[model samples]
Target: MQDGTVERMPRQDDAIRNLTMVVYILQIVNLFGVPGAIVGVIINYVKRDEARDTLWDSHFSWQIRTFWWALLGAAISYPLIILFGLGFLTGALVWCWYVYRIVRGFLAFNDGKPLPR
Candidate 1:
């Protein structure tokens, strides 16, 4: 080595955090669609074991729940729309809830805090 010093790269957990945050932001911008959410959830699953006992555990749990719940919301609303045309309101509310979760989780992550119980 030139100076007997080594550069340290970012840790695995840090990479997971950063990548997850990027996925959230992309979703917020509507540039991601379902594909991005799936990618984020996959990362969450892969790193979940590593995140045990850490604040990231909550974040991962919250994120995965968000995805499933949001999907359920959409599915429920679709039938309502087809059968009664009242699904618009339900869909809108679900969209808002999804956005709220993303923003809340993103902020908590940046502040190094766990999601609320």
Candidate 2:
């Protein structure tokens, strides 16, 4: 009414968004080997504080949890492979779970939404 200027909403930090994407990409590459996941989680730990109180923080938390839980699942599943080949089933389940987490998190990140805590 008074002025013809439009107000703009604040934008998220590009660096944080880029870092989050890198981790998600790394996690996806994890399907091939452990190194990618390892690097991704390390980045999460190091940059977690920077993301605090922002939407990206939830993503960092999600990724960290995904890594640890998947690791634990593998730890248990691999032993069963030696015991009676049950690990084949358990390992598949863990792999599916891992993929689901990465995909879900990536979708949320792209949508500019935070994961439910």
Candidate 3:
């Protein structure tokens, strides 16, 4: 400690706000499925530091994992959609849930609340 020097604390609200923006942007991309996954990876890589926070690390990690899963799901579902229409629907639903989780986690993190395990 020094005179005229102040330590800065991490702002939970700011982290949540930034994450909320990321989730909304991702939701828009998610509509396009695999293409959205690619965009998400790019966005996440570019904003990795901003996306990082003590309370939100799990959320960010899950976002990356879900992106990969959606990417794989899209690739697998495309060729099987004809034989198994349900594959496409299932992938879309999973992707939607992934986005929903991100939003929920962001809100929770912003409120300085513990995440549900």
Kindly report which residue stretches of model 2 are placed more than 4 angstroms away from their true locations once superposed. 1-12
True-structure RMSD for candidate 2: 4.5
lDDT of 3 at 33: 44
Quantify all predictions' global Cα lDDT against the true fold. Answer: 0.79, 0.93, 0.62
lDDT (tens digit, per residue) of candidate 2 on 28-114: 999987579899999999988888988899999999999999999999999999999999999999999999999999999999999
Question: Order of all candidates by TM-score, from best down to worst?
Answer: 2, 1, 3
Stretches of candidate 1 off by over 4 Å are 1-6, 29-34
TM-scores, in order shown? 0.81, 0.88, 0.55
Residue lDDT tens for model 3, 1-117: 578888888776566556545654674566754355456566656666665655555555556666677667767777777777877787677667766765775566567564543
Clash count per candidate: 0, 0, 0
| The candidate that achieves the highest lDDT relative to the unseen native structure | 2
Model 1 residue pairs with clashes = none
Better of 1 and 3 by lDDT: 1
